[model samples]
Target: MIRTIPKPKKSKRHFLWLLGMKLMISSLLIFFFMSSCTKEGTISLNNTNDNIGAEIADSITVRTATYQLDPLPANGKGIMLVGEMTDEATGNLKASSYFRIGNSAISSVTLPDDAVFDSISLALPYQGYYYGDTSLTQSFTLHQVTEEIKLIDESNAWEEDEKPVFGSGSTLFTNNTFRYDTNPLGAISFKPKPTSKTDTVFVKLNQMFGEDLWTKVKSGSNQVTNSEEFLEYIKGFVLIPSGKTPALTAFPTDSILMNIYYSYTRTADGKKVQENLQMKVDDTTHQFNSLQIDRSQSLLSALKPDAEGELSSDQTKQQVMLQGLSGLVTKIQFPYLHEFVNRNDVIINKAELTIETPPSSHTPYTAPSTLNIMLADEHGVPKSLLTASYETTTQAAYLVNDLSGGTRNSTYTFNLTEYVSNYRGAMEDTKSSLYLTIPVSDLLTKADRLLIAKSDDSLPIKLRILYTKY
Candidate 1:
């Protein structure tokens, strides 16, 4: 048997009577609270910069996950010999980059008839950047590319959000290694007092190899006649670390020249005229930096696309990781944030997010210099957060001096007042998650990562909100 439902008709008089009752009740309530009203029917808002006597306040721990970003720029920032590091949160990271430089001379590339190769030195100017411990001496190997290190033409340039693929071109070179102390072992003199971020370094290359190149130039070889032939003859340079240093990054550009020093006896006299031919470095030096991360050793390495507990109620498996060039970020979500859904009359005085690291995490490890909290898509691409007004004005982090030496100052507290206030009705649209990552800098950024505190951690992550329920 089938049953049919009937529609009931509404009367205009009954509707008018119900609306009148509601207005009367509202008027009476307004009159009762008139003493506390700023407007005829609205309560007055008291603003408190700090959390003071909050009428409605609560805290919650959100879920977090690591998000791997796209491939970093191939050769723009500089050279890299990133040492390996393994942590429970950030996984394993090892970045090694390759670069290709060409002859600077336009034409008339010549050598003295009696010029005898004395020595050659690779001079590298500093980029004012370095990572890892300077306590240990490090070694970086230089290789010659057997294949052309061509530039990515605009036609072949990857999309803005596209991650690049890793390429290991067949490069040829005799063994050339640079071994040096990262720090001065004895007294050092500098006209400007060379800082850790500045100064130049030199590595002596094989003189025999330098002579071989000079021989080719004098033999009328195509390699010395033209830039294209030179690039084809001596493809490019690549840096390979010995893996002894914890981590290291070096910036090498065309200015990082190979100076060929030789002496030629003048035909007029028995005098020796010493001249140095410098390999040119200019805008034509096409370069790229590539990062390789081995997640096999990472504690969060097992996370999968369909992994459960990513944002679980218990919060054991969820984690937030941020690394600059390594291309990783963390996604976050406060499931219960809807509790503050439509607080139209409330004033969000303060909303601070405190993230604490576990005891198991490495201490004294240099954290990311800066960070950003923004909305993210399913692909982990970041978007602007209209509510994160203070994200720019506020400092990314502060020094929590632990002079007393306890757990009081080990946490990273981010001011999220403007961000939380922007989300007054944002939940309806952002039903999925937000993200935490290093500020994007058009790939000019460096290698840095931070591991946020998870729920299972001793301190865990908490979002403390202090608002006035006017």
Candidate 2:
């Protein structure tokens, strides 16, 4: 999917920019040398002037393209994401989660002989993470997973380094899927109150389904005797989004609960009593989301993931895309860095990369709180995270919101002084580039997306540098 470009011919404007920079540096050097000349026309090389340093330049050229990476490993992320949303730039995306149910008390469920089963319900607690238009009601179906929700073959899971951090023993990616019963056990439709801590969405399961489980426990069958036996009897569940859900919502795995309701006869008091059997998520390491992105109807439709994966900003309305769930990422290349290296007289002091989004694009969906920059090889494969100076932690570009009740000044900035200083040597690999992406944790778990304007837009991406002449 990766292609290399030949060195492009410099345009007239590029030539002029370099010429102007050289002239400014030459003027400064001449002024300093002339001032240090002695009476006999001998120049004094010793100079201790602290004020003569670092000039700022914000005109460096940055080329951008939308690049697609391989599917991300997504199992056991603490949260479960589900729903579907249509995006104008990257097309439609749908998210679904698969999880198993287990309870240590299943074996000890000793219901009264006179107890009668009622119904069952599944409850999901919100994690407050949302994307797309939330004004409309959201809907999805709950299906019983017919097949065991276990990892694919361990040997085929992932590269050793790319294994899921929370997987039980193997790994699962966004591309992995499990089979579920054709008929839904339950379904739900409601307006989401993601911010309300106490608000929860519940789906009432079919009476027959609840009765079957209750009957097993009441009869003391081996299927309901122990947690391991229970898993074999009922594999798991999958939350499948309806065709036109307005937004994607998130739920914490630890808070998901399923309950079976029933009424029992109290012989001593001659009264009826109510009781319920509760089930919680069995293994957090086995829970995962299955994400599908359909870019067929958007500008990204032209991207070919297996061969020639890059879609230039020029072809995308002068904008690049950054999305989570391994959908798309923006690749950046410095086409004019050679001009700075050729002079060799100036030392790079500071370099900042500024990225902006058009205010008009901001709708109910907001940008991600942070983005990551990664170093890529000649083949466009991510190599390592770009980190802060003298630190192992990855350097992230934090979103700076526009405070005027409008998103006019929204931007993300990164300090690339170290990177720009060594860009000359990095040029050895002609196709080396930097990728702007969401954090790995979010990329594998959330559905957030962002659009970055290119150089032709009103608020285009820019790389500003501060240099000091020797």
Model number with the top lDDT: 2
Residue lDDT tens for model 2, 190-259 = 9988877999999999888988888887888888776677888898999989869658999999889998
Model 1 lDDT, residue 336, Cα: 63
Please give, for residues 83-102, the per-residue lDDT of candidate 1 as tens digits.
Answer: 44545555555554455545
Candidate 1 stretches with Cα past 4 Å from truth are: 1-53, 79-82, 86-89, 151-200, 206-208, 219-222, 252-254, 266-269, 283-285, 303-319, 343-345, 358-364, 384-395, 430-432, 442-445, 454-459
Q: What is the C-alpha RMSD of each candidate to the true structure, in Å?
A: 10.8, 13.8
Cα displacement (angstroms), candidate 2, residue 261, comes to: 0.8
Worst 10 residues of 2 by lDDT: 37-46
- Model number with the top TM-score: 2
The TM-score of candidate 2 is 0.83
Query: Which residue pairs come into collision in candidate 1?
Result: 71-163, 74-288, 74-289, 75-287, 75-288, 75-289, 146-171
Give the CA lDDT, 0 to 100, for residue 153 in model 2: 67
The true-versus-predicted C-alpha distance at residue 410 of model 2, in Å, is: 1.8
